[model samples]
Target: MSEITPELVRHLGELARIRLDDDEVTRLTGQLDAIVDNIAKVSQVATPDVVATSHPIPLENVFRPDTVGEVLTTAQALQNAPDAAGDRFRVTAILGEEQ
Candidate 1:
């Protein structure tokens, strides 16, 4: 039998700052117990000879190799800027502090 009890559920609820009434506590106790039992069953079947996998079937990378492509020059980048200061774009200070 799973070790999940009503007291443990109530304690978890308190730790998470959640207020669980008696009805909710009772309901969650059974649900949590079932989940724990299922996990236990999986653990029993997960032997050293068994291989663990995220997916049942093998997956291959279907993406292109990461390589540098065309990039905009500084002048090309700042061409559409409404305001420019030196070689950078300028906007009004948001924090009301002088630069």
Candidate 2:
């Protein structure tokens, strides 16, 4: 089993800028040791022939084709605007900048 010492935990806490009490450090030592042991077990089972994958199941792009479809005209789009210029929507100037 991998050993997670209190000194290691204290060093890690300092590096991460986290304050861990003595009780927390003691608890984390056992938890981190268990995690490392599990990882070691997994490494033993993972042979070179086995392929690595991010997900258990296969994945593919599910997006629809980008085909051009019927769209609204400028006049139709600007019809609901509170203020409209020649061919676009108009809004109040921001940041004290002149248009």
Per-model lDDT: 0.93, 0.93
Clashing pairs in 2: none
Scored by lDDT, model 1 comes in at 0.93
- Please, what are the lDDT tens digits per residue for candidate 2 over residues 1-99? 357899999999999999999999999999998998998889999999999989998899799889999999999999999999899889999998997
Model 2 alpha-carbon miss at residue 3, Å: 1.6
| lDDT: worst 10-residue window of model 2 | 1-10
- Model 1 lDDT tens row, 1-99: 569999999999999999999999999999999999999999999999997789998899799899999999989989999999888999888887886
Model 1 ranges with Cα > 4 A deviation: 63-99
CA shift at 26, candidate 2, in angstroms?
1.1
Off by over 4 Å in 2: 64-99
Per-prediction TM-score: 0.61, 0.58
